[model samples]
Target: MAEAQKPDLGPDPSLLILDDDESFLRRLAKAMEKRGFAVDIAGSVADGKARVTTNPPAYAVIDLRLEDGNGLDVVEQLREARPDARIVVLTGYGAIATAVAAVKAGATDYLSKPADAGDVTNALLAMTEDMPPPPENPMSADRVRWEHIQRVYELCDRNVSETARRLNMHRRTLQRILAKRSPR
Candidate 1:
């Protein structure tokens, strides 16, 4: 049986969800489909940019970091292509600076990764002047710090010394953080 049409949030029901994580993208697409979006999925910045220019959706969910480039590039292009489109930036390593940047680049909202379809829907359909509610499970400060460290480490090709040098921290301290499990 087909699910009923979701409540009208806009004239267009077309939604685009872009992410490099294949499994998460697929799962979110499925859930959003159930919620009545005509979903399109893209796995890279280039593909997303192309899609935006050719056929921009009314709503978009883009990841912050991708293999090719920052997702903010896509957000800017989509905003240019469809000025009224609702775009949400999703990132696993969320930060205050990046959140502000996403907004500045024309994103309608920003969400941390592992967000459920319900949360995405609420954001996509929110009133124009409404202030978004806080995330259901915002990352702890320790978790955010750990994720940032891991990101820098990976960017430095997983070289502890280089990562430490770039972060301006001792090598041993970086090692200890890397060895420990991620904080909740």
Candidate 2:
């Protein structure tokens, strides 16, 4: 009998990750390198765009909020320049609206921050395949409100004071929103 052949599972061609958090970027790059990806890191949206333009990577992981600009611009550029590139958005802000926008803007996947290396790996894997299901709909007003709250809430790491401050509302109002979202 003939011997069976095994499929090859080699390192990916290349990957780029963009984020303002230097420590996180460095750690992520190292982890991905161990996983056999030739990784590049960019600290700002402009740098990310420039790198992509100069030499596009097979995969890109972007943060939705950047110090220089919103990460969506990078997403748009990637869509135009390298349509086959797999893109994933990692955000501290993950509201339904932004998630919807990310999908429409051509991101392959979206994940909340505090995401682990595995999350990043799975996201990359997901992007290489066809898109998965859209987020559920007929969203209740409360659900929508909750999603908004989560987006901003996570953006500020559930700090009522900071989230309220950023949202331009009284702390009490932000508290009330959270209270309403929480089940009795």
Candidate 3:
């Protein structure tokens, strides 16, 4: 007699992607679906929360900030709904504090923004005990510095001198950096 096949005991590969960027959200949803996940997407925290309450997925990739509110709120809801769910938080404004908050809020992993579908899939499927692979393209030190300066400039209400003072950088140097396009 033929041997019986054992049933697959893994959780279903259902994924929810929440981001405010319209093009990015649709593109990511399609890519994830092609990669064997049943994907549901939302553009705002309100929509994300409603989706979680209605049908929480086994996996989630949520942006850190949204027009409606913080994505951490959605993460909280998902965690409450599915404690075992694997959630990855994505953010353009990467910071140590927020990354810690994400993990504490039950995120399986935290990734800086512009993370591709492949990265998202890997993060969702990675073993919780294992460390995630390093990013394919980590930001350079110059780029990080530029980003920090830009953030400070914005927070200073775009006052060049104030931003320079806050960053402890020279006013002329700050102007030159601001005039130039962001480094990769």
Candidate 4:
């Protein structure tokens, strides 16, 4: 009998993760690396753009907000550099407007924050035309409210008074909510 041939297993693909949250970025990078990807990490849009310019990865996970600039800019750059790259955009403050923007900028998919490595992996490797199932349990109203408030607060430079004025809420009330942990 003829000897059986072994299947070919090619080298792992490269992955880039861009996020301002250092802890989350490191954790995700380590997880992806363990799952057979050569991972690169950037904490800001500038760094991410630089990385893409130097060497575009086969896959990317980008946070919507960055310290230096919006992640969409990086997404556009990646699209230009490598049109076939699979890119996923992540955001803590998920909004319809931003989701539309991400798609327009060439993201393969958009995922809200708190997504695990498996969810990201599935998104990057998905081949079917069918859409993924909607989240079984979406964020509660209170959680959404809190998230919006927090986003505005951050945009206001973490100034309680400015955030209060922007939201038309009392400064003390804003301070109280900020002090407490986010609601579920």
**1-184, model 4: which lDDT tens digit per residue?**
1123311113548899999999999999998877677899999898999999999998999999898989999999999999989899999987788999999999999998878887787777775486765555668889989999998999899999999999999999999999999987
The reply for model 1, stretches above 4 Å from the true place, is 1-7, 155-157, 162-170
Per-residue lDDT tens digits for candidate 1, residues 9-118, read 56689999999999999999999988889999999999999899889999999999999999999999999999999999999876688999999999999888768888
Deviation from native of the Cα of residue 132 in model 2, angstroms: 7.4
Per-residue lDDT tens digits for candidate 3, residues 64-89, read: 98998999999999999999999999
Error of 1 at 49 (Å): 1.9
Q: Lowest lDDT 10-mer window, candidate 1?
A: 1-10
Considering every candidate listed, which one attains the maximal lDDT? Answer: 1
Model 3's C-alpha root-mean-square deviation from the true structure amounts to 4.8
Please give the RMSD to the true structure for each candidate, in Å. 2.7, 7.2, 4.8, 5.5
lDDT of 3 at 9: 19
Q: At residue 139, what lDDT does model 4 achieve? A: 80
Over 4 Å off, model 3 = 1-9
lDDT of 2 at 85: 80
Local distance difference test scores for all models = 0.90, 0.78, 0.87, 0.87
Ranking according to TM-score, highest score first: 3, 1, 4, 2
User: RMSD (Cα, Å) of candidate 4?
Assistant: 5.5
**Model 4 regions lying over 4 Å from their true place:** 1-12, 134-138, 153-179
How many pairs of residues in model 2 come into backbone collision? 0
- For each candidate, give its TM-score against the true structure: 0.84, 0.69, 0.90, 0.77
How many residue pairs clash in each candidate at the backbone level? 0, 0, 0, 0
Global Cα lDDT for candidate 4 = 0.87
Residue 99 CA displacement from its true place in model 3, Å: 0.6
